[model samples]
Target chain A: MNWLKYIGIFVMLLFLQVFLLDNLHWLGLVHPFIYLWAILMLPIELPRWLQMFIGAAIGMVMDLFTHAPGIHMAGCVMAAYLRPLMVAGYVQDIDRMKGAITITAIGMGNYLRLLAVLVVVHHTIVFMLEAFTFSHFGFTLLQIILSSLFSYALILMFEYLRKNT
Target chain B: MRNLLQLILRYSNFLLLLGLEVVAFVFVLRGNKYQQVAAAGAANVVTGSIQLMSDNIASYFRLRADNAQLLEENARLNAEILELLNGQTRKRDVNDTLSTRNREPLSSQEAPYIRADLDYSFIPARVIAFSEDRHHNYITLNKGSRDGVTPDMGVIGKDGIVGVVQSVSTHFSVVAPVIHEGIFISAMIRKNDYMATLHWHAPNTRRAALEDVARHVDVQLGDTIVTSGMSAIFPADVPVGIVSDVSLGEGDSYYDIDVALATDFNSLRTVHILNYTHRAELDSIQ
Candidate 1:
């Protein structure tokens, strides 16, 4: 994998997340977490520990901006820890791939399923921890489901655009 | 020892996950306990600087609307000045009659009480960041401690009260805006002088509730609400909002009134921090 390309993508995604998506509150329910694209697209061969560390770093930076420390970090690290299992289930030859992960390499259906799974896991954990209790369990679940759908659509659109261009 | 080493090696990834999760959990716990002030402050400084840059870019897009609002405020002030000037000629006669009607004569020691004057100075600031969608919304101002902005000072936009200053950094300060659930202001109905407490029900930016006004008060829709000046933070008669709805349930002693907030938090960009010079004196006496 070209490290420079990933670094460039990381920086771009971070700015996009902080400046654009983070500020958006669609009907006060859907907050698109598009920054996860960087973690989600890391080379499959990357070490598990390194992936977790990177995810933690990215999530902490996000937490810094959103004024909620550690929430994003915990969620992102959990997603990173589970990413290998998700990818392995879809892409059997991930080890032989020499480039960064792209939607075209895996079929769109598998790619979207992987994205949906990661986003659902991340949003569920993040929103649940944010609520901190089951007092408003239904509302929290609504937020998780709505935000996951919103984020998945956005990430899918972003991936499609990137793949085409 | 060999078995233990094998067990650790076999689940090293899980162990690392647990270790990272613990670190993250510590952050969550500290954040929940409000022990993460240093981190939050540092984050504020960094995000404030970035928000300032973004505000500079975004301000250009809002210049037309801001100019219109400024012009409207200026016109209102000019009209007020004209009214005061016109009332100056009749003021002496009114004062003479009022003094004669008084039960006691004016004394030199009591002269300060007769003269109406405000003790606050306004520090102009630009809002670099504002959020209304959250349960706890906050506004970040460009002015900070270096600029003589301190905590507990009142902030108002051109139209009405914004919030109270919560914290300050070297170059920035955070305001606990009126939209936040925790904020409450002592407000009154401008028509009948009935006092009430103004509070925001969470997740709503356009409206707030004026509580504790007795049911018998002649609270009507469209009545103006202004700060009662009971607290030293805001001076008397600053417009807070207008009554949008009034309701009472059977057996309830207090009327529930909804107010359409005067300051639109969504478009709020510039504000003035009210610095009451006599706040310390007032606090000491109290």
Candidate 2:
């Protein structure tokens, strides 16, 4: 039953990422990658290997959709590896079955901080790899900042909606 | 050995992360040049089908705009046909003797006056995916190798030139649109025949620059620019754009001309791919 729920979430996130979020070219700058929600919402106590594998799989799917083969996979893998470190101090006890390591369970402030750090880290690596050089450093940095903020805001909104409902 | 094994086990997660990242980096490196082409060919097979499905749904909402553009093109073509017919009738009435003379075999000196029939055919294709947000924009079309689309074939929309086909799969082709920084077409001012090269400079979709026209040419705002047909890819006299602005750089020998492009790429849906029959012969001779 628990595995079924995670699989369902994975499929839903993949569909949303490929069909919806990837197509939204808002201002040609901020592409809200809310698909990261799947990795971010994983149970805090999940095995690191499994989490990293899931992140890489999701990233590969995104890369296939965007016609960009590997940059997203690299970024997502990095994010998955760093996930525990980001939430280590805040998440004292992780509920495995409920898997409520989300914003509602972790408090808003700490959740936002975790979201910001991970998003920035992911976007920075992704954009840098996409650019492949420091020649367009300013442009790449701007993209990373704008896209991270946009993704953070979208995740926050979803968290609020889930809490209220 | 025991200590080393324990250390490896303790940091196994980090090692796993490194291994995955290395694999991803390999994928990126493989996507650099020649390998990237192969990857894109494979990627297109999957992405093309998905784009085709999405385009089917999205095309419904764009029917009105597409219809208007087709109507406008139809009207223009009708006017051109009427003009041609009128000129033919007037020429027939003006000179029966001269018309008879025109039928006679032309001398070697008059060979240049003989016009060869256009050797081009068009294959219609619908745009399944288009992006103008990037510095290097690409357009994906529904027609591909199976439909006779090949690399370097010119694509034109209703209003003007779109781009050249860059790559092709079994059922899809990718176009390097004129908006891409790398695309440059030989163009000329319609009024004076001053030749230049058209290329995208600004990020705006509706604008591009015409370069290399001499400073002495009387270029003005609102002057029409058309393809020069120097390259056999596109036919001559296809409308490219109107000159929106022109300026001379200090101490420079050429004019910096800005053109408002004829094709509105944002609303592009359907295009015609030009197939030049004599392209191989011409290429071989060149």
Candidate 3:
């Protein structure tokens, strides 16, 4: 594994997330968080434990920036824990699942499915835990659905941009 | 022990999920603003009924003190009556003054709705539970929406103003009292009509700071503070407290005056909830 490449992506994504995207809330309801790209870009060759460890580290950094401490950590860890299961579900041949999650590495259909599931799951947990109640179920659910779709679109764009990587 | 180790080894992934979620929820409960208030409100609702039972029994033992308070208020009202009879009190209106002056003493025949022309009315309520130890203290009233008690109405006791209704259920309502750090009471000194803010910053239950009183005003000892009636919630000129101490810091623009609160929260038994009739209209104007 190239440590330098991973570190570069981590720093760039975290900087964009904390300084830029955090302040840009569309329509005052949806917030597009692109920091999960760091997790999404992880290679399938990494062990499940290490993936989660990296995910938790990313989440902790996000939590430090957000001041709401455990919210991002919970979402990030769950996403990391579910990534491998999603990958296994998509890629039937075990030999093919050992590279970076790119459009070429995983076919277009499986890659979109993986992105949709992880982004929705991560956004759902984060928003639900932030509210900690179903009292305003309508507003919270709308926030989650819109945010998931928006973040999913942005993550797909990022994946397309780094296609040859 | 070997069986336990085998079980742990088999389900380590699930244990990790549980551990991570547990840590996350701990921080959420401890630090999240919404969760903390919701938890506090739910806890108050559960304990409110139990305390109501004990408060009923405990009030019987404190009747002597309560009676003394009522007697003091009665004497003060009687003195006001004598002043009004002597034509020496401040009058809000000439018609009101003339009617009050020519008013005959109540006899066996009196109107049932004497105060029908008044813009506001009071709902009698009992203080079921109150806590002064916490920074953001809350008082629970036995009256709720069922008895026409709603959120944002002012609560007052025999001696002074108490708090505003915060949340109301069917039969119970919680009050964010004057001692709570969140509420800022608008007050004016009776002598000079100097507007200042009453804030409960100091931990002392008996004292609160009268903030923003300009240094130019002569805020003497024993000066009376009352509501300014700038807000739609509270009425004008309701008694607040007395300025117990005043000290001006050198090269300061404001005097740091401390007020000795009139209503002792400890012996508080019953309170009246003020229902301002035109609150919605006043709020809409703003």
Candidate 4:
């Protein structure tokens, strides 16, 4: 039943993103990155290797829709590889956790920590791919910062709503 | 040796990530023209839909401005017609008689105005959406190939040059606006007759730079710039812009001058597509 729910969420998020939020641009460069929801809501107990595989699949699908080749793939795999580390780094004592990876299960502070880390890592990878050449290093950094700020804010707003409702 | 192996194993994921990034880079670099066309087309559709949605919301806000500008332009055209009626006007012949004479029989009188002879004329189109983005700045017009629009036709606004038709569909066409980096216009100084190419720098829409003018040509600030007619796309003597500044490039002989374009593209709503009568013959020869 939980597996079906996850699939439902994935399909819904992808459709909303590809159709609705895809064209909204903020600050001329920043866009609502609802595609990252696929990575953000993955199972905490999933094996590290399997998580990486799922991340790659989602990223490849996003790449197909965006026509951005491997940018999403790079971001997703990076987030997956770091997910375990970020969770471990945030939760000092795993024994104190009664987590099913649900919105209410994970405490708000720790949840935000994981979200921030993944958002940063994913945005960095995506921005670097967009700016393949390092000649405009300063501009690339600015783009990453601006885009990540808006994307992170949007994701947090959605999560906040999920927590309340 | 054991420690080295451990380090490699620990960072293996990073290495894999690096490898994947390299592959993506290669894919983008080697992406075919068809792929680019598909991506651009998709992006255009997405933008077009968004513009269409917002256009409804903002249509009320723009109606008054659009109406006033139309009235002003109508009055200007009416004044020009009145002047022509009074025999005080010097109208240039639109026909390509010089080139036609070379191919066929000799004629002394200049060719008659083709504009009056053509039964079919262009449909004035509204620019529904446009881009000022640095890399690719194209415009989506309300009319397209179905309206007799075709690639290589010239687009002109009330004040001056807008761009050329790049692609066309049934109800819409994309223009490569003069503000785009890829667009170039054959322009000349009206005072001294020195010719050069005009191009946009992407950062500014109001101004473009002129190139290939010799340093010795007499020039001044506010010198009128016009189309050369060297290219069949734009008719000769169409007002392009006015010279705002002039300077010499370092270690270069040609003078570089800044021109303030006559047409304010930011506020441009209606545009006319200029179609040369002899376009088919010119294309066949070329």
Candidate 5:
């Protein structure tokens, strides 16, 4: 039952991203990577290696769809590896927590911090690597900021809905 | 071996993180090369089928526009055929003399209509995927090796040049389009034949920068740009764009030019992938 629920969410997020959210790049300026929800809501107690593996796998799927090759994969792996640190920093008593990382799993203040940092980290790596140069650093920075905000907001809304429903 | 196994077990998490990142970065750095080794791996095959399905549903919306364009082309081709038939009756002797002088006797193996008289052939392909918003934009076509779409073949839309074929899979080919910074089209001013290299500067889809034209060249607004034919990919005089803006810095050796690309990439649906027969011949000399 547990595996079925997680897999269902994973498939749904990717399906939405590739078909709908991808085609709907907000105002043609920002791309909301809603698929990151799959990685974000992974079981908090999963082994570090397994989490990174799943992250890279999702990134690989996105890279294939977007024709980005390694850009998203690199971002995903880094985000997965660093997420534990961010979660630990926010909630000191993480051992008491179980199951997925959700708003209900942690308080709102801590949840927001965890989500914000991870989303920014993932977006920054993906965009910077896609740009591959600091020559147009300002433009790239603007993309990172706009895209991160859009992705962060979308993830927050999904998390909120999950907690309520 | 026992010590090494124990050490690996002790830091497996850190080791795996390092290992995965290394693999990811390899694709990042190597993906952009001409070979596009990372472009169509097994994963792309999975996504390619999904894109094909979506494209089928999406293509229905564009069917009316596609029909109109087809009708226009059909009308033009009919006119050309009618004129050719008229010319054949009126001046058969002249046509025979001029055409036979440069040609050998018709070979038995040749199918007259399949390959055009020119050195190039074209495979009609529909765009299955296109991305212009990204820095490294790629266009995926529905044709591939099975359809004879090899790398480096030129792709052109009804309006103008699109890009070169960069990678191929069984059923899909990826194009490194003119909108990408990595692609540089050798273009020339059609009026004066002044040549320049064209590259896409980020943040805009409709415009690209034309560089290396000397300041003294008689370039102007609305001047035509076309492929230079310096390379085998695209034939000479294929319309690239019309010059939209041209400016020269004071005492600068070259003109700063902007071209409104002929093809509206946002609405690109179909492209003709040019199969240049003599590409190998040209490559051998170099």
Candidate 6:
């Protein structure tokens, strides 16, 4: 594991996200950079413990920047915790996929499986966190669905970019 | 001992996930409480800077409209000046002015609309942003704590009540509009002579409803409703809204009357954050 390389990517992604994308309010209140995709896109060979730790760290940095305390952190850790289960579900022959889990290597079906789980978990945690008081469950659900769709679309766009590059 | 060790090792990640999630949950539960003012203070700085830049751009567009309005106002003032001069000149020429003045009574039916008293020497402000959403409805203004706009200051436009100043920073303030579920203004129907609470149902931005008023009142459609002035927030008889419809149901205790608000929240360019001299004194006593 290249510790320096992972740390560099995390800082750069967070800096761009909080400083640049955070200010970009598209259509009043919608900007889904989903740069946390960098963490989710980490190699499957990395230890599960290390992955969860890194996920928590990355989420903390995002929360610090955005003033949203723990929602992002919780989302990232959940995806990290569930990554193996999701990957195992689709990879019938993990050896055939070159032992590397790039979107192209895993195919669109598996890629979407990972993406859907991560996005749903992230958005659910975020929206539920926002509606922490529980006075407006219906409104909170609406926020979750809307924000999740947008965030998921952005994550997919990033995946497409990574595949093309 | 070996089985217990294996179990602990196997479920360590789940425990870690729960631990991190608990930390995050704690933050969410304590959301916007301890660090709210601090977060808001920081956000205010960023919002202030952005608002300053946007205000410059918006100010450029507003200049032309402002000039036109000023010109129109000047024209009206000039006409009034001419009429006053003509009346003065006519009075000077007429030796029979006493008889003409005596013919008209001191108290006539042409009384002007009684505007509630407000302090004239307070800071002026303009509405920069208005929320159309139901969940978090509010309006941002161009003045703040530096402008003597503290939280809970009464706001009004030319026609009627606008809202109360909710939060204030160095150069900006957020107003909780009458349409927000947060506000409860003590109000009374003018025609029906019944007191009730006015609140926003949130789906409609322009309309709010009267609550707790009994069904026995002789409420007519289009009757004007004004503030009861029971609270020190707003002055007495300040025009609030006009009754659009009153729901007369079989089981409801109060009339579910929809009222079209007097001040248009969408198009509100400028407003007055009323700072009364007697507000603090009155509030403390009450």
Candidate with top TM-score is 5
Q: Candidates' DockQ values?
A: 0.48, 0.47, 0.12, 0.22, 0.60, 0.29
* Model 3 ranges with Cα > 4 A deviation: A1-165, B1-45, B67-118
TM-score between predicted and true chain B, model 6: 0.73
What is the overall TM-score of model 1 with all chains considered together? 0.81
With candidate 1 superimposed using the best TM-score fit, by how many Å does residue A9's alpha carbon deviate from the native?
1.5
Off by over 4 Å in 5: A25-27, B1-19, B79-96, B101-117
> What is the RMSD of candidate 1?
5.9
Candidate 3 chain B: worst-modelled 10 consecutive residues by lDDT: B106-115
Q: Candidate 6, residues B1-286: lDDT per residue as tens digits?
A: 9999999899987888888788877765553342332334446555555555655666686788868755865676566558757875787688545444332221111111223233322446887655544333567788988888888777877568888877778888777778766578889988756788998763467788888888777887899999887766776677899999888899977788989999877666777776766777877887
Fnat values, candidates in order: 0.43, 0.52, 0.30, 0.20, 0.62, 0.41
lDDT of 6 at B134: 35
* Candidate 4 clashes between residue pairs 3 or more apart in a chain or in different chains: none
Q: How close to the true structure is residue B56 of candidate 1, measured as C-alpha lDDT?
A: 88
Residues B1-286 of candidate 3: C-alpha lDDT, one tens digit per residue: 9999999988786678778878877866664532133433443444456556656776797889879967876786676568645663345444454544443332101111122343566788888766554345567789878899877889887778898887776677888788876688999998888899999852467889999998889899999998888886776777889999999989999999999997788778788888888878877988
Off by over 4 Å in 6: A1-107, A117-151, A154-165, B1-38, B58-116, B119-121
Query: What lDDT score goes with residue B242 in model 4?
Result: 98
Q: In candidate 2, what are the lDDT values of residues B29-108, reduced to their tens digit?
A: 77533223345577788889988998898788888987887787677656655875787688779965655433222111
Candidate 2 versus truth, CA RMSD in Å, comes to 6.0
Over the full model, what C-alpha lDDT does candidate 1 score relative to the true structure? 0.79
Query: Which of the CAPRI classes, incorrect, acceptable, medium or high, describes model 3?
Result: incorrect
Give the candidate number with the greatest lDDT: 5
Name the best candidate (by DockQ).
5
**What ordering of candidates by TM-score runs from best to worst?**
5, 1, 2, 4, 6, 3
Cα-based lDDT for every prediction: 0.79, 0.78, 0.74, 0.68, 0.81, 0.68
Ranking by DockQ: 5, 1, 2, 6, 4, 3
